[model samples]
Target chain A: MSGNMNLTLKIWRQKNNKAKGELVNYKVADISPDMSFLEMFDVLNEQLITKGDEPVAFDHDCREGICGICSMHINGRPHGPKHGITTCQLHMRSFKDGDTIVVEPWRAQAFPVIKDLAVDRSAFDRIIAAGGYVSVNTGNAQDGNTLPVPKTDADMAFAAAACIGCGACVAACKNASAMLFVSAKVNQLAHLPQGQPERMERVRAMVAQMDKEGFGSCTNTGACEAECPKEISLVNIAAMNRDYLRANLLDSEG
Target chain B: MGVFSFLLKSSIGKKIIMGLTGLFLIIFLVVHCGVNALIFMNDGGVLFNEAAEFMATNILIRTMEIVLFLGILVHIFQGLYLVFENKKARPVSYAMTNGNANSKWYSRSMGLLGTLLLIFLIIHLRHFWYVSRLTNELNANETLFDEMKEVFSLLWVVMVYLLGMISLSYHLMHGFQSAFQTLGWNHKKYTPIISAIGFCYSIIIPLIFSIMPIAFYLGWIK
Candidate 1:
């Protein structure tokens, strides 16, 4: 069906983490169903600019799901109602004419609200900074098969590397736990032979940083897995637990 | 936090304590159920009382009982604390929540079931353990089976016992495998088996417990 629609949006507006936030309503008319959700927002922003009103603030980049920057809770689910796709991928066609849609930021203690529908996700960057990387000498790229990597290990690592570091997992959890996100990072590195030297230290440092970031503990609720835009598995979490336990048991600190 | 403090204060560490205590209690259920099943012989609780006497009198078993009590206390307190910590993790509620989409309702309601089981445990210990172990005034020799008869005679008491067993069953169903998961006992081939064993054990143990009270109330064993 070829039709343009009128839609109402109730967006969360906050000046900063210290400021109080509330839902502010606005309407956009004659929007083509073909426009992406972010594109629809663009139209609304343009309208606000014409009216000399401050444009709504939100985070996005690449317009694709690759970058984890685009984060928003649409109708209570992260990255909007559709599964496996970020908010930028959601199209106006998913909604009906004259329907009201709710948009909010990822509400978690670690992710303080930055502005309207935008949160400060620097905590994730801090976690990654703690132990998300392996030490490799700076040089030309080595041969891919030099480390005798198994196909299964490579496949599993790739699956975990699919995590965009999006804060959606934290937002979807009832406890606001970042286990899924942290596990994805930990498992991805743990599965690779190149990641061996720092495996124990990596898990410990990352978990410590995660806890320091004030994120809640995971209770295996599976919400993070179900809500992850990458569709990451819960097995990553199990793997992280195994690695962490081994690290603790061995007391490895070399 | 220091290393020991980390174990006590950290989320994953608290989960490890929960897993350990839950497994300990699961084993206790086996012994409890095994001895209680002796009443099925219909010999007027002779074997049941004999076994009960050994459990009460045996020095080794007595020592283990204290450990069991400590484990239960830690499990209850830490479990509640975990529930409380998780609640604080999300200080703000979502405008609309669909938590059921990802996990089982029973798994989420573990806190409530544990609280119910705590109440049941208090009443249960007061009924038998308190008298049998705490004091010699219960019976010169007939405390084991006679106490069961007297307790089951009251329909409300029987109902509470049955309700407690029900809560225990649900709690076990989740706790059994969840404890293992938290302890990193996951395996592709073995986890499913562990889950199945937990499921069957949960049902069978509680059912045996429930049957004893019902049997006594109906005068089937007497």
Candidate 2:
């Protein structure tokens, strides 16, 4: 962590989607190995600004990685080469001195380029808006332990609820598929008693919105899980499928 | 209509559509592969031609073809939609890097490969199915075996079919495991075994189909 090291960066820079983009090269020297990847980028950008170059625009918030805002495709892997860590949490120690890194935005039609390293993720917002929330009458807060939920159900719900909405699953996906993210939301609520009233409507609305947003189908590839900073399970997808099936069947009668 | 509408709206509905339609496609592949395997049975213009013609001209088969088209459309459309949505949901995650060493190769390339298969299907149906419907005399004497052989004779065509089969296999490897899991069939006791079965089916089915064209083109069989 003490020695200075120089690293090469090949970064994708696009003024806009209509404009052609390519990987522009940069070099950094005297970098501490203890610095995170984004922190390293911070060093590089600081150098660029001092030289009158436009600094790289990357999305990040809560460097702790819980916000799911820091998106990057590092050497073709989402969230850099590490597993289960966001870009902000990825430390420079993982890379060798004088190593080269290729950086690009998440590649998918749905995630259009907003800048050099940012994209318009509002489509996800629409899908969430479709049915991501539970409907409850306004009143006093329910007691935390009032519901007699089975341990397994509680565990599964908690696990599903842990999805941080990072686009890593989509970026990691070969087809840019979103099944993991959507499924996590669906599963989180479906497993809980609080999610009952609008369970059917929730699945239906979210799925419709998912389709309307031009996302690809889940082909069951675990790339989403593999690259997920949260390691969200593919099981949520199964749960979503099951809920949708039951919802459709029951709705068919009315 | 409600059932259909429900299918469009729910996660499970999308999944049921995916599962049922996917299984349907799998069965269709089995049957189609079985019929093609007939070419290996007799070394003449008899069995394979008869089967293909029957399948092509039969009322039930035609009805099934229509349904098959519907299934493919739904599968492809829904698949693409979900992929796009997933991409947007997380604006940024991975930094540019090859993080695929930890994941199955099939999982990372299914979409691009599935798109390849779609293109293959279009050309395949056109040359084999649509062309056979033309009233030209050129289309008259072409038997299924002859048409297949003719198609495979082009080295590039055979190559494309080979690539297509590889893509299909990759798709099936992940897809089979997924379809079962979607149906809540994940028994930890049997999940790995089921995954193995799914893997075998993916590889063997496409291998069998890919071989026929290459074998026929190589004149390994009459």
Candidate 3:
């Protein structure tokens, strides 16, 4: 309380996708430096509700950075100027006493705004539905070492599997493409022995779903991986490409 | 429904369509650039013009043109669709954030650059294709070299060509790398190399294409 600081907040407010929204300003005081950015917002929201005003709406879950649900463009940067942490994991100490924080949702034509600080992320689920799953059966409850997958393949699969299905890749992409996300999923499946059974079919289905989901084509801009909280490599994207090519060529020839 | 749905519904299906169409267009550009480069090869404009004329009338080439048009349409449509759905799918966020510092500039701006490239394509086809078909059709005696020079002599034409090439380059910057990723060639060891290749191709192709018009206009070629 002795070192508590006052901060200015400019936040986006919209009723829904079709409604107009503007950044509303507010002043918050006595905030702890150890408070997370979302915690700071929580304090602000508590005050607003006590004043009988509608609380600001935002999306957050599993604040630990695993759910891929936290996304905010703070002061013009995604995830609030952090290197690899989500908004929930971001603490107040990153800012000073008098700093002005501007908060907004992911802005893109594909990501039509649903409400203030909330956009529809079901596009990702649909993309996954298009072909993100592995249908191969390798027998359950058996020894993990039975398959004898190469360590290299296992490592790559682990990395690719790290994707949390966040729309950050889409938000970060200039074309608003989800190629990185889709390719990660595809590569995760393609790298392991289990993934080999339906490798070609998997890539074919996933890429098709990504396209159907209205994501833009990849432009080789490594923005997705750079913004990825998990730091998933672009190597997965290339691997997805090789498999996709082989699948297409084989599909056509055979 | 099958064709339309296949384009809209299937990820690999969409990519295959996209890749095939893109590859075809790339082939066209390479050959077009190669033919234009002929001015540097021959002492006069004779070789390039003859080649252009033959290409314009050849039955095989004519068939390929129809395929090319279809490919362009599919590519554009699918690309647009993907952008739309990607937005719709990710409707909510868990928290507020900012820029993706790790990704490539081309990947993020592909759609915007692509829109620019589309406009450029229309203008380019109109100027080069329609004009060549109607007015310049009878200029068989004029070498492709002379015709290109005449076209490039206009400052506006040079600007348009330059802009067109730049857009194409931007498109390639993303398109090349993206196509590979969708196919699952994402090995950590090879990705950087592939991205480098994509960058180089994007820059070189446009640089070469843009130079041809400028060279023809500057009297760099006979």
Candidate 3 CAPRI classification by DockQ? acceptable
Candidate 1 chain A worst ten-residue window by lDDT: A245-254
Question: Per-prediction TM-score, chain A only?
Answer: 0.96, 0.95, 0.93
Candidate 2: lDDT over CA atoms?
0.80
Model 2 / residue B195 / CA error / Å: 2.6
Candidate 2 chain B minimal-lDDT segment of 10 residues = B88-97
- What lDDT does candidate 2 reach at residue B99? 42
Model 1's lDDT to the true fold?
0.86
Q: Residues B1-222, candidate 1, lDDT per residue (tens digit)? A: 344455675567777888889999999989989998999999988898889889988999999989998999999998888888877777766676566766676777888999999999999999988878887765645667998898888999999999999898988888888888887877889989999999999999999999998999999999
Model 2 agreement with the true structure over B1-222: per-residue lDDT tens digits: 854765666444566677777888998999989988988875765788888878878999989989988988998887776666555544444444464555776666656777899999988877677766553423337676787777878888888889989989989887888788778676657889989988899999999999987987898767
**lDDT (Cα, tens digit) per residue for candidate 3, span A40-140:** 98999999999998888888889888998888777766676677778888888988889999888876655677888887878778767776776655677
Higher TM-score: candidate 1 or 3?
A: 1
lDDT of 1 by residue, A1-254 (tens): 35899989998888877888888999999999989999999999999999999899999889977898988888878887777888888999999999989888888888888788888889999999999997786367668766688898988899999999988899988778999899899989898777898999999899989988888887766778888889998788878888887787676452
Better of 2 and 3 by lDDT: 2
Q: Classify candidate 1 by CAPRI docking class.
A: medium
Give the lowest summed-lDDT range of ten residues in model 3 chain B.
Answer: B92-101
In lDDT terms, which candidate is top?
1
Model 3: what TM-score for its first chain? 0.93
